[model samples]
Target: MSETVREKANQSLAMVEEVTAVVLPEPAAANAVVPLEKANKTQSAEIKRRMAEIDMEDTQSIVSFGSAAQAELQEISQAMLADVRNKDVGPAGDSLRSIVSTIRGFSVSELDVRRKRSWWEKLLGKAAPFAKFTAQFEKVQGQIDRITDNLLSHEHTLLKDIKSLDMLYEKTLQFYDELALYIAAGEAKLADLDATVIPAKEAEVSKAAEADQVMVAQELRDMRAARDDLERRVHDLKLTRQVTMQSLPSIRLVQENDKSLVTKINSTLVNTVPLWETQLAQAVTIQRSAEAANAVREANDLTNELLTSNAKNLRESNKMIRQEMERGVFDIEAVKQANADLIGTIEESLQIADEGKAKRAAAEKELQEMEANLRDTLAAAKAKKTGLGDTAGGAVPG
Candidate 1:
């Protein structure tokens, strides 16, 4: 045979060997075990071995159904007469005769089997059909098994590759989830600083607006302290952003590597798309979510800087209003103007904050929806993979 044909044949044989083998149950009694252990294994193995050797082309089997008036029937009658004083029927004889007829129907018939068979057929499932066709059906199936055995033999390299691919995906998801969680935490912190803590500190600055010479100095000092605290917090955020950003490229690279694995796993799914295509869906969904998250993070980063600057400006403006209020030259109209300015600042900042929140919420929801889909797809893939393995490895032999 040509190398290609030989390879194909080997592939087919490997499939059978990997996918199908009979296992015997433990013996019921100790004595039975001693007698039956090797015998049972040997018998089952022989059946499979014979099947593997079957030649579909130029193979033939014939079987003949016997007539009721065969030589065995007359011989049975003569043996019965010698055993009995009179010609008679007995329960034992009737049961024996029935058993004999049933056995003869299959065992004593001329062997019959098929001729040519495809390389894809299984040979061992034809035991019962030997009566109708012939044993060639079993023989063709055996050839198919032989071919399957070579391709799917023990230590299949493909299985190892699949496991390696699965490991890569596992790492990819871990990074995706970790990065998402870190960003979410940072967003929460930014929101807290912008909306609650910073605003309260600014309100404190405003309250101290009416200080005299010494008090005005004291108030300015407090304002500076608040600014310093907020600045430090902003600095910390920048540091965190640096760390997270640095890690992102590595994460993205890992995600990219996972794409190749997804391709390999999908090819393995073959016709079982509905069942085993989870990896493809998971990899695609995560990639999209990571992309969206990266975009959102970039936006939020700019917003963070804007918030820091705005807070600083608000603190300075507040300090100035305090100094004027304490100067006793505080006109009623001036106070009103200060209040109006404060309201304007609050409204604009609140709007920006709200928009940021809405965007983050929407992005998070999308991520969550995709996560649910990933789980469902993974389950289907696992089930389908299991089924494919079982079908090839668990077929019974003739």
Candidate 2:
């Protein structure tokens, strides 16, 4: 056998030893002890006995110890990959975002429960500000309930994913153990072929006559081919084992992620949702108290304005009444002043008449001058026309 093939076989044996140490620990009985060399010889004898049972004409049986192991590993791998591909935490994340958004959308200010009432509404006691707030609260509560339901649904899904990952993790370990056994068996068969079977066959080929030498050599060649094929199969199994080793940790990590998501969902459901609802209830109660206080303050302000306005009107009415009552119906001083005013008015009217007469005479004289100027201008224009006509008539021959 080549050094590379020997090294690979040694590596596979070491891996199998490690797996055996882990899976099947030694008994603690002090009297139960076996020599290492003796144990190895026993194992080699069993491997050789198994190999001997395989017909040289059919080498397939030599590597058929765990023929279905590869297919089983492939099935496990496909299942794990499908799970990894399908696992999604996006819905849970979306549920959390929606919860936050819904909580944010809820606002006491939007409810407008503290809006001031009109004068008529206040007088009739018809204001119902809290009605709208109650209606809006019910709507927001429904949204919160829906979000909680969605969160619970995601929680359930995450839990199921965790369980599925647990199964896959177990399946991977099972395959890992099986591959260890398969590799150990293949390595044992290869070692026996290289160390004992092939050398014996080569010796036979050298001693045989020319006619039988070719047949012996051909059998030796067939044995070597079978050994090569077994080696390649063992190497392929080791690769598959490595894949299972890698898959173990990957499965665990995915399970951890799912478990963490479940924890978050539980926290939100058990702690956050109840606390949020409590806070919301407290907020509504506080808002109602604030609205009541505001309404009282507004009423006080309206009363103050009415009182100030009525007092001002009363003072003005009393002052007018006192002034009217203190005055006489007709005083002598009032009659004398009225006679003086009548004389002054007549004299002023006479002075205005004289001024108007003088203004009319001046306006008549200006108008007569304007008419005289206009007649002179017309006479001059007619004389200029007649002179021009006579000059034209004298210039003509006929």
Candidate 3:
């Protein structure tokens, strides 16, 4: 060929290369030539040889070859992928198989030599890595399942313990309420007895003297009995405390040695129980003592009234003198009898008041002790519960 003709040919080829960005081997694969999504051995070797000839020094040509191969690989991948997708669209079993087949087809497509991976490289080519992923995934999933089991079991246990505590709170409240009512009733009864039984025969010295001594002895007996019963209830409350302490470890939060955890539990306990316990106790004490004291004061006022009335009657009777007695003047005997009856009623009332006082004092002491014990046990339970929560939530600390 002439130099000018050859020069023109070369320039034309370069222009075509720039425009198409592909420098194919002369007389390249034709439209009539079949394409394989999977490369045959000979075809793969030719692609490799052709790519090795192209160098970065000839950047234009290499990029052109890479582009053309990529386009060819893309078309092949699409056709094969569609064929595989049609064959399998079920669950995990078919999904895994489809992925494997897709990866094999991709490996065969790499015969184009310049083909690069797509975004689904990990997903489509999962044969080697998927096995390992599946193993670890199952293990992590198993861990989640175990954590779920712990959650359910812990929930049930926590609920049961909370229910027990609720019942204990109610029982404690009942004790508080009963103590209050008992003290009130006892005081009222004593007040009535005091007003009714103080000594109708104080004017009859011998009868009044005998009644006073007997009444003092009976008052002592009643007080002692009430004190004994109160002590017994206090003892039983102590027993309840002991039992609760034994169960404390199961829910104790303190031993975890986490200050935030311990503080949180303390806050919760103080918020939920101790504050209420104190409020209730204070209210009960105020109500019971106020009612009892008022009754006692009222009875004493009645006693003072009776005394004043008797003094008036005695003075009036004295004026009647022996003539009144002979003529039944002023009925001084009726006044004397009334004074004796009032004295007897007052004595009885005083005895009952003393008994009620003794019982209430015992109850207050017991409840205070119970409240302390409750606080301690609740703290323990909270510690345990916190420990359980941490264990359930995270990996063990190194």
Candidate 4:
């Protein structure tokens, strides 16, 4: 073969090498199955402790220091929210924010009542954590959402670029075929020209083919550079996707934890606080009633003692008057008048004592009823506390 033909053949082989630049190896399945991060043991443990169902201890604290305990509870919820909010989304920030907007809305009421919580109020409080979790979940979910989009986008772009390169490879291969044929035909003409009178037209044709081969080589080099860039981008995108996907489970686990914690806080707020408040109020009321009843009983006893003394004194005076009459030294009219006044006074004293006794009995009975109610309330509160404490466990696993 002519030196020029040999050169052209070598150039065509180089273009073939450039064309292979566009072809990418299949990414390992292991890459897609990236190991996900687990929830932080410390954070998970803290969540369990803080969000545990309201127990007897919590109820006592709320009852003893209502506002202070509530403030502490609020601080915990706020801290959880803040912690989740502070997590870095890095390049996934935009995607995460967008996702959060579409999720369920979270709203916390700052309107905490200073007075005792009612049964209904406490029940409603249990839902508060849901709001907090919703807030946290939305934030994290948004990041996950963006991460997903990026993964898909990168994959799509990589696939599109690979397809473009494949088409280019085929076109370049065809060009190689045409250049080989031209080189062969040109070499044949050069050999024939050497044997006979050299022709300018044959020389020009060979020269033009050589020029075309040079241009084709440059095109192959440019395509090779482009394919190299595309491959690098694909590889980087795959890694990013894997990391992001792996990170997802960990984030989701945290979200699940947030949900669990919120549920517990709400339970404590609704069940423990309200029940404790009601129990305390009822106890106070019962005590007050008992005190009032005791006072009425004491007053009744004193009244009866005074009435008995007055009766005894009247009886003694009557006995003296009778003795005077018996001794024949008393006025009949004075004795009759004295007897009438004493009888009337005695009847009034007996009537007043009867009314006092009746009132004291009624007060005692009412006091007993109040005490009974208070006892029952306390028992119910205790049972609820025990039940809630037992039921509250760790957050549901993701």
Q: What TM-score against the true fold does each predicted structure earn? A: 0.19, 0.59, 0.21, 0.30
- Give lDDT tens digits, candidate 3, residues 1-398: 22343343344333323323322222211121212223367644443444353332343443343333234434433543443344212232332333234323322212221234555875686433323333433443344333333322332333333333333334433333332322223233233334543332222334446658576555545544443443343344334333323323321221122222223333322242234335434544554565567679899999999999999999888877856567653577888998899998999899989999999999999999998777666666665777855344343224
Question: Is candidate 2 or 4 superior in TM-score?
Answer: 2
Compose the digit string of candidate 1's lDDT tens values, residues 188-266. 3344546775666556666664654556555546544544443444344334334434444443343333333333322
Model 4, C-alpha of 341: deviation from truth (Å): 41
Which has the greatest lDDT? 2
Candidate 4 per-residue lDDT over residues 289-367, each given as its tens digit: 6556767999999999999999999999999998877874557788999999999999999999999999999999999
Better of 3 and 4 by lDDT: 4
Error of 3 at 31 (Å): 99
Model 1 TM: 0.19
**Each model's RMSD to truth, in Å?**
71.7, 21.8, 72.1, 47.6
Could you tell me how far off, in angstroms, the CA of residue 219 lies in candidate 2 after the best superposition? 1.2
lDDT of 2 by residue, 204-284 (tens): 999999999989999989988877877887787777777767777787777767776776766676668778878878878
Better of 2 and 4 by lDDT: 2
| TM-score winner | 2
Worst 10 residues of 1 by lDDT: 61-70
Query: Quick one: ranking by lDDT, best first?
Result: 2, 4, 1, 3
CA shift at 280, candidate 1, in angstroms? 42
